[model samples]
Target: MATPTQVPGWIAVDWGTSNLRVWALDDRANILAETQSPLGMNAIAGDEKLSFEGVLISLIDAWLPSDARGVPVVICGMAGARQGWLEAPYCDVPARPSDLAQGAVQPNVRDPRILVSILPGLCQRDDADVMRGEETQLVGFMDAHPGFAGWVCLPGTHSKWARVSNGEISGFRTYMSGEVFALLSQNSILRHSVKEGWDDGAFADAVRAAKVQPASFLHSLFTVRARALVARDGAAVAPGGAVLSGTVIGAEIADVLGLLQPGEEIALIGAGKLASLYQAALGVHGHKATPMDGTAITLAGLTQAYHTLKTASERI
Candidate 1:
């Protein structure tokens, strides 16, 4: 909760497919308070009873200023999608992240105390790829590591691998490794074999095998089950999940390796188990990944946008 003395200078939001996270920040962009909801764009879009403004007000009403002056509410992610609050058009690649705030679109709202702006996502025409929330995180990372030029990997359901030169994102590629893994482990035949528990050795081995014989990825996936059934080994049965994970992740990395420069640095932006997994997996290929926290990067990005927009408005 934010006390009166800690009145937020503005609000930062990361509204994604399945989650909505909000943060109250002071003039210096320090977080005062934060909250989240499962009612993301997908949920709100499917339910007629839910309205974007209504949901936002419900979550942040208490944080709104008592004065008439409106507080800026800077949002990133799917909230700017075509089906979101209002379409914040895509900013094409070779675009600077700090400049994304200039493309932000404001939606009409009944609230007098809140002025909202949704940041535009990044897009590539030739490759026909797009990203929403992840761009903001990249902005934050680039801000922290100025002059960085290399590959930046954001691992998720639809993992993104982007190339940064100077300070602009030249291009990127997406992989559905996470989503595919989920379907295979939960909805596909592998569900029966996949179990809870992790075997570092099994995972590493699967990664190496995938790298060596990338063409066999499809067939190797089935081995997660076959190895469990025939071998009856504790390592195979208990860590089937790890093996499956490694297989897909390894395949993703193997494909992405072609895009990397011979000795270029890789920035792995994420946190928790997923980031750790990627760090280790990349390590297997003898490429050390520099890890960064996803949340912090996102907040830094939103903060960056807020300041950029604010400064522009102030100049006018």
Candidate 2:
């Protein structure tokens, strides 16, 4: 039964595969209320088309005023995926991230209090790579560093490495390092060997080893269990997590090294721990990375889209 101090002019949403976040914002872009849900795109029942809208309303119904009509809801991320509420097609790369508003798609909604628009993700045809939510973070970063031109890395379950030049993403690559780490640590035989703690020395050394022998990267993964088994008093237990992490991330960096210029600027977009891990790993290879808060940048990107849409409506 919570209510905002003022009626929100619009809403901002970032709906991913596993989670959904919504914000009620005033006309000046200040947040009046915010909330999140586990009912992501994947959470909606496959046979129910109206499920997505229902889940959204259930989470934000309190924020909706009875007399207000068509409060704009700007959404980004997997909510626009092929399996999502409505498939907002990909906008090809080599394009300005802010231009995503031009291709935004409106989904069918029964609610009179809200009008939803989903932003299109970016794609690179020749490379056959695609991204959804990360583009918003990239656009937000560009809002802060409009002149930045270099590697922009966002680490997560599916990490993204994008190249930016003149405010447009020229190309990008995705890595399954985080997902791989999760699988190996949770599902594989390494599950028993790897634990919660991190060891910096073991991590840095593993990074060097993986970088030097990228071809044997797969071979190195098994050592997590082997190292744990052979050591006395479970000495290798704590370092197992770090070693596994370093190996995968190291190999990812190895593949991208050729694409980077000497002494180039690198923008690392993510939260504290993962970003710090990447910053440290990149440091091992003589690279310096500048970090930006993930949530702030995402909101900035959504804010940019809101303004763009607002201005366009004014023009019409």
Candidate 3:
């Protein structure tokens, strides 16, 4: 539990589809108290009885002090989607990363102690594609690496590759690579065949193979199933999983990685196994990636939005 004196400024939240994380932070963005909940956008959409603010308040209301008249709250992620707490709208691509708060909106709330500011996501109208939470992360990454120009990859359920140039998101692509991998591994026939963890040698081999035969993607995926069936021992299942992961990831890499012009480095923005996997996979293509912590970048992004909006509001 955080003492009342610890919360110096506003609250930060990353409210996604499946979960929401709230952080009580000082002006320095030093977290005072952090809390999480299963009340995500999906829960709000599925449960007709729950309002978005109702869900949000249920989780973090206790952290608010009675003395604060209206503490500022900055939020990111799916909470800004059309189906979220309140629609923050989307800023079209080829937009500056700092301009995310330009499309910000506030929720009609019952809580008198909180002033909520929801940051908008990014959209590609032609492709009919949208990203809800990652834009904040993008801003955070740019904040950390000022003047960084490169191909930045946010590896996740729906991985995103953004071309950041001159402090702007020049353009980007979203791949269903992670989401597809989950479906294939958990719900499909491969479920029984492969488990978590991997064989590094097998993973590297699979990455190389997939990178070569990008067209024979389905055939490559099947090799995992085949290997699972023929394996003499249980040891091969992990490698089978690795191969499956590599194949899918490689296809995504093949799809967009060539845009990496000469001397343009790769910024792999994420943490844990997913990011590590991306780093290793990029290595196979003779590219070195600067790995970053996704959580830190996400927090930095929300903080940036807060300051931007705060400064703007003060001007008015």
Best by TM-score: 1
What's the lDDT for residue 162 in model 2? 94
Candidate 2 per-residue lDDT over residues 68-111, each given as its tens digit? 78999999999899998899999998878667988899998999
Q: Quote model 1's TM-score.
A: 0.93
Best by lDDT: 1
Ranking by TM-score: 1, 2, 3
Pairs clashing within candidate 1:
none
Higher-lDDT candidate among 2 and 3? 2
By lDDT, the candidates rank as: 1, 2, 3
Task: Pick the winner on TM-score between candidates 1 and 3.
Answer: 1
Tens-digit per-residue lDDT, 98-128, candidate 1: 6688999999998888999999999999989
The lDDT, on a scale of 0 to 1, for candidate 1 is: 0.89
Any runs in candidate 3 off by more than 4 Å, and if so which? Answer: 195-197, 227-238
Q: Identify the superior model by TM-score, candidate 1 or candidate 2.
A: 1
User: TM-scores, in order shown?
Assistant: 0.93, 0.92, 0.91
Q: For residues 235-298, what per-residue lDDT tens digits would candidate 3 score against the true structure?
A: 5354668888889898888777667777666889888889989899889888888678888888
Error of 2 at 73 (Å): 0.8
